[model samples]
Target: MVIYGVYIVSKSGGLIFNHDHNIPKVETEKVFSFPIDLTLEYDPKKVSVAFGQKDGINVGHILTSINGVAVNGNTTEEGNDVKELIENEGNYPLTLKFSRPKMTTNEKIFLASMFYPLFAIASQLSPEPKSSGIEVLEADTFKLHCFQTLTGVKFMTVAETTQTGMDVFLRKIYELYSDYVLKNPFYSLEMPIRCELFDANLQGLLEQIEKTGITNI
Candidate 1:
């Protein structure tokens, strides 16, 4: 559960920095649980919720506005407004509005098979990763668990199932990065990070996980 890879994205959608922690040098067996993917169509600007799950988020609705900003399907806002929203959202409750799509009986019956796992192209959408929790995707050879951020960064691990608290974990990483990396006067924007404090904190996270006996699957 402690495997981590973090990177920062730029406004133009570029990855200017990354920090890796405890990447596996050897392959291992993967485990997976039943996953319910609730996304239709892969536009980050437009999000949806899918129906039918045990512990579902019930995200089977169309995204309307976030933080009072209307998503008018306008490209003009991408550069200025969207960029600012992604980068400078400092510890605010993200308020989102959504509308559900009317579904046909046949569509509802067949929707279960349309689970959208992490596609290969998902990584290239942003220059940096986004703010997302960890989820498991059953691949051909293995089930991969990933921690994805909305800006285009993904922290992946090969495991049996996805775990919760990845967002909480990542926010902790960001807080430390903002303090030890961004707040550091010598740290240049988007440059490759070489911070000892960040590394030390990351290492501490690994130690904490091991000490608590957190199971991987």
Candidate 2:
């Protein structure tokens, strides 16, 4: 279970925090499916997991195609295009092709910003009123788990498919945010988190997870 990184977004769709873990790797060619639910009877769980680092896709890979349609851009527009394509129930057993290219810090920030409107659009497009936005975005190589606080702040974690108890872990991160950032008088609301205690606690928590392999906390 590899944790790629964590990103925190403000209520208004600004990126407040971004942390990328230092995981060594070598670029290799691989292809895999990204999991998505459709209105059809097909079960999403039937999708296979990524093979491994030797040939498996991981974070920083640029999505180049969905099924046979070529996709470009890693910006919000590209995300919306992909979202619309995925929502088309006809595209079952989705085939996603990716090219491994290290994502820059600016790209991560742009991705976070792009997701904000997508989340809102998802809720608005829902047939059911008062629907919760996207929670989990699963791919053959990685799984993105998102937790939205009542106040509209969002905490997201990027990890592998085998990672468990991430929801519980996200809630703990929220607690840490509340205790360390919210309570800090020097901290600015809806701004980048830079409190020393918050950074210390977050790093300590991540170190604990790395050492114990205990994600439940």
Candidate 3:
């Protein structure tokens, strides 16, 4: 049987996360197997686990016993074990383990469903600007660039033309930047927004504008 633990770390090399499972939450009667193969299933994306052999021990061959009930994979079915068996009530453990190995069909489906919308949004967020004729203004307070698109629309940016720009005419850019870029939990002030989430939101807004049938100026 495989023994496993979950841990989260900062990009800066800080130990900011950890989790261990003691109980199962979801039902696995029809799904899962021994030697669980874990994969992340979430929007905004999340971390997943992969086990390795240790001391010649096959960690992938382990089984999970939740509340005296045995199930395979890294997830547990509801009622097989008491809720919060792994962590505690209201506290979600970041890591879990399973008996047996291999990714379950249900697990893969769940992961895909969880990430598909995010993936769609990301595809939309790619920077495919529709050429707007706006002029860039170089000034002390901020630098600006402008472009005019084929549609007779004007696009302008101030102070380094980030995903977010200063002031109106560029309000959408600023709003997109403020909410999706600046307000991101992981982003710092003045930092560029280049994550999957940012891209998704950006694409969504641009698509909305495109659909509105507004002529550009």
Candidate 4:
């Protein structure tokens, strides 16, 4: 089954946070304890949370707390008290009561495909890189990394980057494109990839780069 959950990570390779809401409807009244898996190197302070609500359902408001603490709006609840809760970490079961339930497989797939175009637009809007960072080595060759991935499309040409840089750029591109663009509902695959808002924002970013006389990098 397509498990739905949220994962938070740092720029560093740290799986700082994780939560899986796999409770069946029949067990709604019952409380279940789930383990918070963290990487040994995970430092909670420098982490950023990335939330995925199975098919973009607005479950943010539904996340609540009966005991312990609940951090809403995509940030861990701060303060020394909150840290104390973690120090006493054990099987903490937060009762999640919901009105609407889990989605079916067909529903999830349809939602995922609908947002695929955002990826395409992102790829199109990324500025061509310079010889150092991103460059068109030949008529059919182009270098791409985070720029292409955030937009959710891959270049038709090859990008030759040092193995390390390529890895970093690819990982970032995958994460952003998958989370931001692919999870959106208004996006669709049948339609042409055109994001007026992203275009406008990207134009502004390009203009800023131009002003600095660093357009190609």
Candidate 5:
């Protein structure tokens, strides 16, 4: 019934399929072609979606409400309402409502590539826009945690489950950038992070961290 462990609603609002991370197996066919940039954060509420894909949710789909509760103003309040509703609903299929605007290129590709936040793409993509904070997310296999700086640089890692000290870990990553990549005159200031030295150091750091046992991560 489900492909790719996820159901996608087509552009024409047609029934594609249904599945979630809890699903054990997903065929490869039911994949979303478009790279989605959803406005999970309520602040600076302008656009809801972005990027290119044919049979997928287009750019600029205005999310009006979640589970019949309108997202009027005060996103924190609306976010709470959504959370309570979902908890009470026992995690069933949610009736989401949104308005579609004419699709256009967002043209803001600051990052050359995204590291495929598996949880975001599979389950949902949104976060409370605050500061360089850490969030732990559930995924099909591993627990995914991320921290993003104000300047929009993101560092993420996969673990077996949620752990503390994640904020500190993310800060260490930023520190590595400050010490190696940014200071190097030859390194270009960009999103893709194409510095070989940075990559090597990051991997070495990860390996060192990995040996500390799962809970420490």
Candidate 6:
């Protein structure tokens, strides 16, 4: 049960907000593993590492293991331990494993933009009149769940195929959006959401969902 990302697409086909969850990938024998020696630039402020001009690793990759030590703690104290290990100066030849999202931000934005037209086509081609377009698109590995508000803003979640209760989760996302984004005085209509309050609340919500899954949230 893992959520890869959340995307908020505006009525006019603009990407307002995109959030990639830092979840460890489910280990499988079928999955390929490759070792790449690359220079890493760590941002203390973000507690994240970035590879200089590197391919493969993306921004939302979660630090799963470091030097054979599994850093899979969710609690504060456990997280502090992982932080300490990362900041320690003596640990050299860092062997790290990360769970990275499949798509990049640019790719996500492009997909979101393409969805509007796809939605329109779906509605037109529907057997029943007044169809609501594509709702849930299930694939071999992932599931895309979408809930469109009356105003045409679509809240979408990319999650594991077996995960459920995404409709409820998306509704909660709408409630949070209404509260933190729509209600913010500084927010411009249909613009990219930049509210700190919204980001904080959404991150908290994502963390909750990550820990407990959609049903628990």
Off by over 4 Å in 1: 1-4, 27-160, 213-217
Error of 4 at 19 (Å): 40
Question: How do the candidates rank by TM-score, highest first?
Answer: 2, 6, 1, 5, 3, 4
Model 6 clash pairs?
none
Candidate 1 per-residue lDDT, tens place, 1-217, comes to 4444444443333344454444443211112122313343335555454443223234555545555555543212333343334335462444544454444434522421222222334544545675233255565544545444454344334332343445455556566666787788986664656788878886676567656634331
Candidate 4 lDDT over 127-172, as tens digits, reads 8533122222223223323223222233211233321233333344
Candidate 6's TM-score: 0.63
For model 6, the stretches where C-alpha displacement exceeds 4 angstroms are: 23-102
Q: Candidate 2, residues 140-214: lDDT per residue as tens digits?
A: 888999999898999999988898878887887899999989987877768898878877888877877877775
lDDT of 6 at 3: 82
Give the top-scoring candidate (lDDT): 6
Q: State the displacement of the C-alpha of residue 51, model 3, in Å, after optimal TM-score superposition.
A: 58
Residue lDDT tens for model 3, 27-80: 222222332334322212111224443322243344344444543334454433
Misplaced by over 4 Å in model 3 are 1-169, 215-217
- The collision pairs in model 4 are 119-151, 119-152, 122-151, 129-134
Report the Cα lDDT for residue 60, model 4: 26
Per-model tally of clashing residue pairs: 18, 0, 42, 4, 1, 0
Stretches off by above 4 angstroms in model 2 are 22-24, 28-101, 213-216
Cα lDDT computed for each candidate against the true fold:
0.46, 0.71, 0.36, 0.34, 0.44, 0.72
Worst 10 residues of 4 by lDDT: 1-10
Candidate 5 global TM-score: 0.36
TM-score of each: 0.37, 0.63, 0.23, 0.22, 0.36, 0.63
